[model samples]
Target: MSDALLDIRGLTAGYGDVPVLTDIALTVGAGEIVALVGSNGAGKTTLLRAVSRIIKASGSLRFLGEDVLPLTPEALFARGLVQVPEGRQLFGRMTVAENLMMGAYRRRDRAGIDASLAQTFDLFPVLAERRAQTAGSLSGGEQQMCAIGRALMAAPKLLMIDEMSLGLAPIVVDRLLDVLVAIRGQGVPILMVEQDVFAALAVADRGYVLEHGRIVKAATAETLKSDPALQKAYLGSDS
Candidate 1:
């Protein structure tokens, strides 16, 4: 068996009685960057919600070899299955440092939290430059960094990010993607649901293509990037 850190099988979830995701199965192995590519309304965010327990879902969901279907969102997060939602949902009024400190709320070890915060600042020096600044006052990219830094402070084993490059400039996106690679090098697997197929596949080790709430393709990043049909369908390129 592969060393899968987060595994989902036969997952079907939706709002109330309506199903948006159907028989979805995917896995994020240790130290892998796995991207999920799809169009709008394809249930990418819905799948994240289901996995995080923000919404109800059926079937098996495992993390670090533990069955997570029975855990509440808070419990799952404490167990190191953390999510950095789309829109970089920071506590707007809170200072960058305060917002980051929130990520370690479940932890009791003071020294470890301090080390994580220091590591986060070291990774994103711009955040260190703005630690006391209000999160709402930062630029779009800086806010995204803070949001990601906050997740890092939680010491996540698996980081699930939605629309990571959304509404950001190309340079900023590149910077964020680099950080993701570095994080993966440090043995944190990422399950990224990204709107930018090119950007996501560029750094991902593997990718899953979802269309209309169902995964239509799953392969290595190179395979997905090289597929002409996938390019036509998602990138709208006739060539």
Candidate 2:
């Protein structure tokens, strides 16, 4: 945990006066893809909301070794902590390029921003092809790609993706997993909350199993993939 780029200890958060996540402890270390897997209401999204400062969380939170518990959402964004929300929240009326550019609103480096844009387009070629197209007009998979591309536009140090495979075909999910690995190769660690447990384990170096808002299991990806209880719980098969 000493090398963790993002660390959370004793984190608890939820909607107004309603507790959801309880005493959550999670970490994403450098050059690693750490998966958080659980059922729909297991506080997966709530934890992300807390980390991004969209919801208040009480805990010892640190990012890049700096205590970030008091930082505002805007400050967190500027610090290279980015999240790709669960629904692929794209600005429907805006062009693909425009939406991506919005990720760099806080940045003043014109050259770096342009370079990052080119990098994003290269990563998701479909986005480049539809650079001028309105986000609302894209297919579901394309929209997801656009959402991720927009996050990469920010040049994030740590990328947290919620439900990257939601509503996409298995093939599309595989492609995005490949992208996550590629992103990791580029030195950006990822903390992903995935609906597809197998897909998440396949690419992640490690995984944390969340049950009823608490971490029940944490292990290497292969260990988790072969865990009997998890196999039956999520995959519905032990074979």
Q: lDDT of model 1 at residue 120?
A: 95
Best by lDDT: 1
lDDT, candidate 1, 109-157, per-residue tens: 9999999999899889999999999999999999999999999999999
Tell me the whole-model lDDT of each prediction, alpha carbons only: 0.92, 0.92
Stretches of candidate 2 off by over 4 Å are: none
Clashes of 1: 0
Query: On a 0 to 100 scale, what is the lDDT of residue 106 in model 1?
Result: 86
- Per residue, candidate 2 scores C-alpha lDDT tens digits across 110-206 of 9999999998888899999999999999999999999899899898999999999989999999999999999999999999998799999999999
